[model samples]
Target: MTYGEFWVHYLRAHQRTGTRALHYTGSVLALALVAAAAISGDWWLLPAAVVVGYGLAWIGHFAVEGNRPATFGHPVWSLVSDYRMLLLWLTGRLGPHLVRAAEER
Candidate 1:
């Protein structure tokens, strides 16, 4: 799917508050790992970021959303959308996206 289309579906998949929280937590942890890697010169933290971030997100998709992750088909776009979603959430602009997704559903 195109980025726009995928974004809509991604928002829908993350409708649950718990799922969003988990994603936010995971994204933050990923960022922290990257920073730690840079500071400590431990390159392993880079892979850890991917694992921790995607691991939490997948858990939300499976246990909370009961759906497959968008990453399955669009890995790059899914990663981009994950940061976009996290940014929106951090800026308190996610409600409108969620509303739009729900309307489409």
Candidate 2:
């Protein structure tokens, strides 16, 4: 699927508030790790960021969402969409995405 198509699927996969919350938490922690790595020059933290971020998200996908992640097919777009979704959630603008996702379903 194209990025736009994958985004719609991503939104639907993350329809649950709990899943979104986990993703947000993971994204925030990943960002912090990146900043920390930059500040302390601990390059290892960069890999840790991927582990911490995708780990939590995958748990939510398997346990909460009961589905495979969109990343399996579209890794780059899925990663970008994760941050976009997190940004929208932080800005209190995720409701519209959720509505649109539900409509698609």
Candidate 3:
């Protein structure tokens, strides 16, 4: 699959059945925040981004998704996919239907 396809699958993998969709949401949020901070050259936001980003992600993993993160298994791929997904999301193209296409595969 392409990078775009990987991102959609990544999101789907994080979605839970009934509880809040915090894992994917948190991961997306953190990625966007970090990208914004990095682009703005705010060094302070760097630390905050790291803390908040991972904190939110962990919360989602342990609390919401209830599964080990793919990051643990595929660190580099997961990191690259996170940024790619964040860009896709920020561009307003990360809709449910589009990402849902990934599930079909």
Give the Å shift of residue 33 in candidate 3. Answer: 9.4
Per-residue lDDT, model 1, residue 15, is 86
Cα lDDT over the full model 2: 0.90
True-structure RMSD for candidate 3: 4.7
Global CA lDDT computed for model 3: 0.62
lDDT winner, 2 or 3 = 2
Ten consecutive residues with minimal summed lDDT in candidate 2? 1-10
1 or 3: which has the higher TM-score?
A: 1
Off by over 4 Å in 2: none
Model 1 lDDT tens row, 20-69: 88888898999999999999999999999999999999999999988898
Q: Any residue pairs clashing in model 3, and if so which?
A: none
Q: Order the candidates by lDDT, highest first — what do you get?
A: 1, 2, 3
Tell me how many clashing residue pairs each candidate has: 0, 0, 0
TM-score of 3: 0.54
